[model samples]
Structures are given as structure tokens and as C-alpha cells.
Target: MKGFTLIELLVVVLIIGILSSVALPQYQKAVKKTRLMRLAPLIKAMADAEEAYYLANGQYTPFSSELDISWPDGTLAGAATDDGYLRFSDGTVVDLLSGSSYLTGSASAYVMGKTKEGIYYIHYLDHSSSPGVRSCKGDESLCKSFGGEAFNGGWKIP
Candidate 1:
């Protein structure tokens, strides 16, 4: 059996390390973006489900029943539930009553932002806060007029 020289092994290890170092952050960011992106579809799906529930009952709200949810795909864990309240691993909240964490519950309606803290927004993040690209709401600077312009009383999603 042939054995590799220490120098050769060191060079190979160094090369692998360099490649990993350069690619790791990019990989991490991509994963983060992908995870954050799931919020959109999740929001849409939840909104649709909630709308259906509302149409059937004439009031909009995610019933306090077991909801089979797949949390952050890229970063968050899988097979989550809203049986009690929407909660992220980092303690971010997303329930209709507990709109204190990431945008999950009613936020499936409006306002969205992704940070290391996770996707966050408020109940009725904004009225003018369009669902287009780069529409900022829930941030104090934008909702400075008091009563939070995005805080539309009751649900907004249909």
C-alpha cells in the first residue's frame, strides 16, 4: 500500500479548508434566504386556510386546533404545529393573540421581514404596506403616525 506524504496531505487539507471557508458563508446565506422565502407560501397557504375557515364560520381566525405546519425549511425544524400558538425555535411568537414574534399567525396577511431573529411583522403591519418588493412596514419609522398605519383592526386577508 502506498502512503501519502505529510506535505501533500497538508496541502490537500488546506485547499479543502479554503474552499469551505469561501463557500460556507454563501451557503449559509442561501439557506437563510430560502428559509425566509418559505414564509411567503406559508403565509399564503395559511391565509387561504383561514379564509376558508372564516367563510364557513363568518369570522377570521385560526381555530385553536392542531395545525400541521412545516416550519423554516432551510433553517428551522420541520413538522411544526399551531396546536397552542405559533412559535419559532428562537422564541419568536406568531399567534393572533401573541403577535410579539415573527410574522406567523395574522401576519400571514401583511407585513414581513426576515432577520436572524426570524421572519417578523405585526398585526396589520401596514395598510399602504404593499405586498410588493421592499415594502417596509411595522418598523417604527414607517408607522410613526400612531395607531400603526398597518394595524387595521381585525383581519385583512380574505
Candidate 2:
């Protein structure tokens, strides 16, 4: 006599479920966006290191002492493996998009994973390409399709 009817209980449960379902995806998206934004500073730092190395060595080296990245040191399965993001020798980190490590390409290009998926690329744009600017590239197909915001003489989210 003091308990709610089955219909009322079911309605309450359904409402809760619906609310949670709607909010969960939105929360996940926000988290992913935060993760993507968090990498911006790291990418910028890598670019700065590359710039400093270029000035000191007269050319960019894959490896730069400017980065104090923590590289793993140890051997696994009788093989020595180092999990270092900075290449300090060639300025490149292999398979950066894979998220196993931060990556750099060519002389002034760096790419890192964004959020739960995709990748963010920061590199120098040649004057012929975008009037010479350091630009960050997001999902390329999205950029081409949606026309991302322009900044620093190039697309900020391209």
C-alpha cells in the first residue's frame, strides 16, 4: 500500500535511462575535445625545440636536447627497447599518429593524436602554400569539406 505502481516505476526508470543516454555521449565528446586541446602545448613545445635546434645546428636534427622527454629504458623479451618520443637525431618520431609516441616529420612538421581518435598536425606552411605560417591541421577531409577557421595565414583547425 506504500509502494509505487509498476507503471510509475517503469516511467521513472525510462526517464533516467533516456537522460543518461543523452548526456553520456555529450560528456564523452567534451572529454575527447579536452584531450585534443591538451596536446596543443606539447606540439608547440616540440616545434620550439625544432626551431632552437635549427638555429644551433644550422639545420634541424631529428634529435634535440631541448626536449626532456622521458624515454623508456629497459629490455623486453631479450631485446632492448627505448620508448622515447624525441628523436634528437633526425627530428622524426616514427608512427606518431599511432599514439605510441609523439611524432615529427620532415624539418618542421609534427603530428600527434587527438582525443580518442584522429590526429593533429602542426607544421610550417611554405609561402607558396599559405604565405609562410606555422599552422595546425586537423582532420584533413573535414577541413576540406567544412572549411575550417583561418588563422596565422592558414587554417587553424585544418
Candidate 3:
């Protein structure tokens, strides 16, 4: 009588498994959310720095040193490559492009943004045109598309 029966043990195991199945997904979602959130400050900093650089030089500087950012690992300073993607150590990516989009003209317009887990934040600016944030709640694919008249098609940062 002191020991549990097989049926009781099985029932307990089943309950535990069911709870874990439900909880694990939520835990993963929270972790992904946190990872995305951590990029927000960096994105904002880059945008601010870009704007300042534009004000000072009349155009945004692609060099990370000029932007005055203490870049983390995997930070791509400028359009070193054709993709214009800045890969982070955490697997998130940022695309800081000037003008219309990556591989486009040179201008004061700038976009510093990041995407992770289908969430994205884009700080867009063009001194003579549009300037604002383009945020995609879900679906990274949607984020890739130009948001609207107020938003320009940013570079595909992966």
C-alpha cells in the first residue's frame, strides 16, 4: 500500500507531459520575444547616430566608427557587401541602409532596423522626404515588403 500503483504512476506521468507540452511553446515564444526586444535599444541608438551624422555631414556615414557605435560582434559597418546586412552574435540581423534601399543611391535617407522571429522594427528617415518607424507585428515576410507611402523598402537583412 505504501508504493504507488502502475495506473496512478502512469496518470501522473501523463499529466506532467501534458503540462509540459503546453508550457514549452509559451516559454519558447517568450524567449524569442526577449531576443527581439534586446535589439530595440541598439536599433534606436543606430538611428539616432545616423541622424546626427547626417546633421553633421549632410549625409549619413556608413562607417561604424563614424557613427560612434560600440558595435557588438558581427556588426557590419557599412555596405561592405551587396546585401547590406549586419549579422549579430545572437543571430538577429540589422540592415542600415542609406537612400531608397540597399544598393541604391546615396542620400540622407537612412534605415536602421532589425528582424527576428517574425518581428521587426525599422527606423526610417529621409531629410527631404519620409521619416518614421515601420514596424511589423508578425510575419517577417511582410516586414520585407515596403510598408506604405510613408515607408520605403528596406534592405533584406538576414
Write down the lDDT of every candidate, Cα atoms only: 0.42, 0.43, 0.59
| lDDT (tens digit, per residue) of candidate 2 on 82-125 | 34233312132322222211222233344332333553444441
Error of 3 at 53 (Å): 1.1
* Native-to-model Cα distance after best TM-score fit, residue 63 in candidate 1, in Å: 7.5
Deviation of model 2 at 152, angstroms: 14
Cα displacement (angstroms), candidate 1, residue 6, comes to 1.4
**The candidate that achieves the highest TM-score relative to the unseen native structure:** 3
**lDDT tens digits by residue: candidate 1, 19-122:** 99999976875665454444556454544454455455554443434233345554433234443345455444444323321223333343233434343433
Per-model TM-score, in order, reads: 0.44, 0.56, 0.65
lDDT of 1: 0.42
- TM-score, cand. 3: 0.65
**Candidate that beats the other on lDDT, 1 or 3, i.e. the better one:** 3
Residues forming the 10-long window of minimal summed lDDT in candidate 2: 94-103
**Candidate 1 residue pairs in backbone clash:** 93-101, 124-150, 126-150
Worst 10 residues of 1 by lDDT: 127-136
